[model samples]
Target: MASFHLVSLGCAKNLVDSELMLGSLLAADHRLVDTPAQADILIINTCGFIQPAVEEAIEEILALVAVKNEFPEKKIAVVGCLVQRYRDDLVAELPEVDLFVGTEGTAGFADLLAKMIRGENPGRLVLPERSLMDSTLPRVLTTPPFRAWLKITEGCDNHCSYCMIPSIRGPLRSRPVNDLLQEAVRLAAGGVKELSLIAQDSSAYGRDLAGADLPTLLQALLAETDIPWLRLLYLYPSGITPLLLELIAGNRRIVPYLDIPMQHVSDPVLAAMNRHYRRRELESLIAVSRQVLPDVALRTTFLVGFPGEDEEQFLAIEDFMRQHRLDHVGVFAYANEEGCAAQGLAGQVPAEEAIRRRDHLLNVQAELAAARQRQYLGRTLEVLVEGVSAETDLLLEGRSRYQAPDVDGCVYINDGTANPGDLVQVRITDSQVYDLVGEIVPDVGLAKEKNTARG
Candidate 1:
């Protein structure tokens, strides 16, 4: 049995795919290693959505190549978007890599690599992908046992001009409701308290199916699973229907948080980027969300410095951000990727200018997030304890429903005796720009916590 060290790069969706790869290899009797030097094979699941991500992937491969040199017999495998996107280019550019797996990562990888390693010599590249994912496939949960990402759908139908996901990952394919339910049940059984549903287009889940949609699937998941908190991520603004908002408001199991990826709101820029929604529509969306889901922590991402985005257009985006004061916000500089529609468009923003806009907006969001965090002070909320703090073992760190794992900040518990994965009441003592300072209070029941939070 060959020992392998797999490095998974990019988003949470990619991480799930990495887990699937790991599961496939392990099921085939391959052992996993913690580091490159300890392994006979090194696998890299890379992201190539944009040029920068590709550069990052290349850097990782070069680092691994150095390690591979130490043991001349050790094999290197480069997989995922980088290979899917620039397979021909990568094969020529990176002869050091032996195996190349694409986005359609399936059980084929396990068998193919096993044979190739035994037969092959110094260095080369090889591979293809097929099959949809389901509950039947064994996955080693890479995240903490308390929290896991449940990717509901694969690929993207919305082909934004500046984005390459549709080309790299392909079109939408939602998992069956029964299949998802089975997975949820398995996760709950394995002690996962928080399961966040993720996808390229989450709100559009089950659109391909005749009878199933997001709400229907959500009801089933809530009714069936013992998991306490289920959060939604990467929902397009228009897809946040009134019925969906109502369901989230009424059910405590469905955490009061929404992750809307509104790339831009300016009409001209939105049109150029091929986004369907308008400024007025987004305003209405926020207004309705605030009215219906009062406790909801709204999060969104904005792409600044698109090809046609001028100073006036960018100001509109900044103005909208300042007006909304969203709970969480992420800003990204537009990537002028090759083959994207925007690459041929006129009036491209300069790199320094784009970075300037990104940094400025991030600073604005930081101030807004700091102000928004104050509301939690002197209130009670349920926190999923995540063991000792990274900063200090003297303190414990956990996440509230408002805070999504990794992307959002944590609640640092200064005085608390709770194990990891334990769901307990935390009284908000203080707050930061993004993080929170709290103490565990066993006495504050769920009902009391809700009432206290409302006050």
Candidate 2:
């Protein structure tokens, strides 16, 4: 039984993959160590969506290589999107890596590594299969026991001109409804209170499946799992159906939180990027969401400086953001990556200008988020305890139903004795730019508590 360590990078979807790999190794009786230096094997799950992500992954690999050098017997493997996207290129550049596994190749990693360790020649490059993970697959929860990510689908079919997901991840593959529900049941049984449903485009789930769709899957999950909070992420604007909206509006367990990645709001830019929805459609969708779920927390992402995105177009997106005052927004400058259709497109926004736009959007959202936070003041909210606050040990930190893990803000409990994974009621007392300050109600029962927060 070899000791192994993992460095998982990128989005929650990739994190799920890392957890699966970890679970597989653990089931095989391999021990997990805290650091690479103490492990006989080190694995890096990488992201290659953009140039910056690629560079970040490469830097981490190099750092791990240094660690491997210190321990000559330690083996290193690099896997995931980076390997899928740049297999040949990475192999040529990173000859020191013992194995390279892509999205599809991840399933067989444990056996492949075992062969390599046994002095058998397992080929360095693994070709990924076009498939989706089901409930039968093993996974070790990486998130806190109270919260877990449930990736329901794999790959992309949108084929946006500016994106390369379809090429790297292959076509859309939805997991069987029974499979997802079984996994959720297992998670809930293990004390998971919040389950964030994720996919390349969550709203697109079950499109390729027979007689199945997102709403149906959601209803099944709600009926089967006793989890307290079910959040949805990575929902494309165009895929937001009326039935889905109705389901979200009516279901209390399904938190009123939406994460839609609206790349841009300008018609011309949208066309250039091959986004299916128009400006009007996006506006209508937002309006409908607001009308249906008044208290819904809308989280979105905007890609600035796409090819041919002029100042006027950029201003349009800014105007839309100002008008909507979204609960959470992520703004990113475009990176022209090879293999993406946008790479050779004309009128590429300059790097400096893109950075300027990204910064401007971020500043705008900061103020908007601060204003949104002010609403929670004095309101009682259900907060799932995560752990001790990073800012100070005197306070415990967790998130409200409106706040998704990691990407969204957190609520710092000024006075509470609740343990991690426990859901407690907290009354908002103060607000920050991106976080909330709260205290457990005086009468609220905790596993351990001595006095009221005001005392």
Candidate 3:
């Protein structure tokens, strides 16, 4: 059996694809290694969603090529979005790469690897066809023991002007509800307490499936098993339906958190970016969420600079942030990717201006996040213990329901002993812009009992 090492870079969706590819490799009797130096084959699952990401992917491929040069017996293969988007160009530029597999043609990864192992040059296998939904193979999760990213769908149909997702990933395709449930069940059975539902647009889930929608899938998932937490990510503001809101409010399993990537608050910019929601509609959605779930932790990503975005539009976003006081916020300076419609549009903001705008937005978000976290001080919250700090073994790190895995902040447990993956009650003592220091409450059962008696 051949030994291989795979490096996955990009979003959670790309990580899921890499995990599936790992499972395929394992099933084909290939031994997995941690580093390229220890493997006969090195696979890189890359991202090409944006310009910066494309550059990073290319650099990573080159780094692997250096390793291949040192070890001529080891072969290197590139797959995923980067390969999907620039297959021909990459093959021409990076001749050191042994194989280049596209997103659609990834199902045959095992065969490709087998051919390369036997000294056959597979060249570039960039399949133009888009795979059907529910066709995704099973994945071998690469996350922590307690948490797993459950991808409900693949690809995206939303051809946002600045987004290259549609070009590389193809159209939106929802996995079967039954398949998702089975995966969820398996995860739960394997002692996974937290499942982060991920996709290009999670809110647009199941529109392609017959009689399936976000609410319907959530209901089905809730019915199947009682996972400790079901967190949603990449929810489009335009697709936040009333039924979905109801599910978020009523379902105890669903955490009161949403990651809606509203790229811009300005209506003009939104329109230019092909975003369907307007400023008024966004306000209404936030209002409805706050009305229904009073403690809902709203997280959003905003693009600071885009084509046609002016000073006034930037101020509008700042005003929105001040008014809304989001629990978590991510800011990105827009990068013009090749083939994106936004690239052809006029009024491109200067790079320096874009960086300044992005910094300003981040500064605003930092203040807002700090202020919001301060509110949690002195209040008891449930945190899932993830790990202990290396600097100080006494400091345990975990996250509340409000905090998503990587993008959001974390809860630091300063006192009390808890193993990784244990859900414990903690009292917030101090707050930072993106993290909280808390004392883990010992005797959680006693506290619950006391509260129950008082009630």
Candidate 4:
């Protein structure tokens, strides 16, 4: 049994692919190692969504190739979107990489790895069908036992001019509801308390499928799994129907959190990026969400300095942010990846100006996030314990429905005796720009009962 080390990069969706690869390797009796130096085979899952990501992936791969030189027997494999995007180029440029597997070729990972180790050619490129894998596929959970990401769909349909996802991952392909339910059941059975639903565009799920949609899928998942938290990420604004909002409002397990990637609020920018929704539509969507679910924590991402983005367009986004007071906001300066439609677009914004715009938006959001957190002060909210705080062992860190793992802030529990998966009520004591300080509410039932008695 050969030992191997795998490095997974990119979004949660890509991480799912990496986990599946790990599961395949384990099934093939390959041993997983902690470091590249200790492994006989090394795998690097690359991301090529944008220029910065591509650079990072290349740098990491070069570092691993250097490690391979020290131990000549170590086999190297480069897989995922980066390889899919630049297969021939990478093969010729990086001869040290024994195998170059694309996004669709991950299913045959075990066989490919085995063939390469035995001095057999595993083919320079393997591009299979552009579809999602089934629940029956082997998948080792790489996340904490308490939380797991459920990819309900694969690829994307929306050809956002700036995004390379459609070209890299292919068109939208929604997994069957039955298959997803079985996986969710397994995850819940395996003690996963939080199930985060992910996809390139989750709101676009079921568009290609017959008699299906995201709300219906959520209903099935809620009915079947006992997972405490079911959160949705990467939901495009276009497909967020009223039924979806109603479903979220009705279910307690379905967290009152939405990650809508409203790239820009200006009409001209939206039209330029082919976002499909205008500024008025966006405002209406936010207004309806606030009306339907008052406590809903709205999270959104913005793409600043896109081609043709001007000072007026930039200020419009700031104005929209001020008007909405969104709970969480992420800003990224656009990068013109080759092959994307935006690459050839006129009026390309300079890299330095993009950086300035991104910084300005972030500064504004910092103040907004701090103010939004203050609203929760003196109130009790349910938080899922993550683990010991990175700042100090004395303090434990966890996330409320408002906070997504890694991207959003955390709730620091000052004094709490609870396991990682335990869902406990916490009383907010202090607030920061992003995080909140809270203490686990002792005798939660009793506190509620006392309040009832007082009422």
Candidate 5:
């Protein structure tokens, strides 16, 4: 069996694709290695959503190429979003690569590589196909055993002015409800405790299909799967119906967390960005969510420094942030991609000015996040242990419902004996700008019983 090393760089959605590709390789008797130098084949699954990601992909490809130069026999395969976006066009730039696969035909990658290794020279193979997923497809999980990501849809329909998703990923294509349910059953049977549903626009799931919708799918998963925690990511604002919120509120299995990507809060900015909802609609959504689920963690992302974004529009976002005091906030500066509509828009924000705006919003969020965490102090929130702390082995870290893996803060279990994936109650002791310090409550029933005595 040929040994291979795969490096996946991108969002969790991209990671799923990498997993799919790995499954194909493994099925074809290709062994996966831990390091690029230790393998006969090196695979780089790259992200090309924006300019920064494209640059990162290029850096990774060049770095791998440098490694390949030392071992002339070692072959490098560059695949995923970057290759898909540009197709065979990357042939001129990175001629050192042995293979170039795109977003589609992931399952057929092994056959192509076999042909090339025999000197057939498969060249650049960016076919018009898909590796979105299949219920029966064999996949090797790259994430922690207890957690997995379920991509419910492929591509995107929302042609946001500043986004390259629709162009690169194509139109929205929701997976059949039965297909997702079967996949979820497999994940649950395989010991996955937390399953995060992901898509370019998660709330838009089933709109392009027959008989399936977000709430209906959630109800089925709740009834069928044993996965303890179900979370949704990348929910567009307008599609977040009250029915969806109510279903989430009614189910303890569906953790009280929502990742609503409200790019901006100014009417003109929203219109320009092609976001369907206006500022008032966003306010109404938040209001209804607060009323329906008081303890829900509302996580949102903001894009600062869009074209024609003046001080007034920027200040409006700051004002909205102050008023909402959202549980979690991610701020990003807009990128002017080659084909994006915003690239041609008048009154472009300077690169330095964009960075400044991004920094300003981050500072605001830091203060707000710190304050929001303080509210959790003394409260015993359920946390999923995520193994040893990256900072120190003396500590264990986990995440509460409020904190999504990687993107948000974590709860540091200072004095606890728990395995990864164990759901334990933790009493918060301290709060930072992003993280929280806590002690595992050790059997929530026991902890609650002793709360008065401990006090």
Candidate 6:
């Protein structure tokens, strides 16, 4: 059996695709390796979402090429969005790569590699058109055993002027509700306690699937399984319906957290970006969410310097964030992607200006995050242990229901000795900008504690 190593870069969606590819290869009796140097085949699942991401992908490919030079017999392959976007150009520029596969062609990776091994050229394998084949493919889970990302939909329909997702990923296509449930059940059965529902636009889920919506799907998941936490990620602001809020408020399993990517708050910027919501409408939605779920963790992403975004617009976004005091915030400097509508628009901000705007917004968010975290001080919270801290090996690292993995901060448990998957109560002792320091709560019941204190 040939040994291979796959390096996945970008969002959870790309990670899911890589997992599916890995599973297919493993099923075909291929051995998996940790590094490119140790493998006979190297596959890179790349991202071409933005300029920085594209540059990172190219750097990775070049590093692999250096490895290939050292061991001329080993082969290298590139797959995913980068390949889909720049097929012929990549092939021409990076001749060291032996195989090139696109996003739609990833499902046939094993067969493609087999052909390459047999001396077939297998040139560029970009699909002529997008196909929604919900492969019941196996996956070699790369995440911690306790948590796994369940991709409910593939591709995106929204053609945001600043985004390249639609052109690179094609139209929105959701997996059937039954298929998603089966996958969730399988993951849960395999010891996954937390399942984060992920997609390009999770709120737009089931728009393609007749008689299905996100809330309905959530209800089905709650009724069908017993996963400890069902967190929703990548929900759009415009789709945050009253029904959805009510379902979240009532459902015990669904985490009271939403990752809504509100790109910008200014009406002009929103219109230029092709987003449907304006400043007032977004404020109304936030007010409604706060009214319904008082403690809901609102995580959002904002684009700081899009084409035609002025100083006033930037300040408006900053003011909006300050007013909301969001639980989590991600600020991105806009990049002019080729073929995007914003590419041809006038009034492109200088790179320095973009950086300044991004930094200023981030500073605001840091202060807000610290203040929000302070509110939890001395309170006991349920935390899922994810790993042991490297800085202080005795301390355990984990996240509360309010924090998502990787993107959000984690809580540090200083007192308790717990396993990776154990859910334990921890008393918050201190708070930082993006993390919490806590001590594990003792097992002594509240009544016992009062009696002991009295004695």
Which predicted model would earn the best lDDT?
Answer: 4
Number of backbone collisions per candidate, in order?
Answer: 0, 0, 0, 0, 0, 0
State the weakest 10-residue window (summed lDDT) of model 1. Answer: 446-455
Query: Model 2: what TM-score?
Result: 0.96
**Candidate 3 or 1, higher lDDT:** 1
Q: List the residue pairs that clash in candidate 1.
A: none
TM-score preference between candidates 1 and 3, better one: 1
Candidate 5 overall Cα lDDT vs. reference?
A: 0.87
Give candidate 4's root-mean-square deviation (CA, Å). Answer: 2.7
RMSD of each: 2.4, 4.2, 2.6, 2.7, 3.4, 4.1
Q: Give candidate 3's whole-model lDDT.
A: 0.86
Write the residue-wise lDDT of candidate 4 on 68-129 in tens digits: 88888788999999999998899899988888899986766998888887878868777777
User: Candidate 5 at 88: error in angstroms?
Assistant: 4.2
Off by over 4 Å in 3: 132-136, 442-455
Alpha-carbon RMSD, candidate 2: 4.2
lDDT of 3 by residue, 224-309 (tens): 96687889999999898887777777766688898899999999999999999899998999999888888899999899789889
Candidate topping TM-score: 4
TM-score of predicted structure 1: 0.96
TM-score of each: 0.96, 0.96, 0.95, 0.97, 0.96, 0.96
* lDDT value, residue 171 of candidate 3: 81
Candidate 2, residue 47: CA error in Å?
Answer: 1.1
In candidate 3, position 39 carries an lDDT of 95
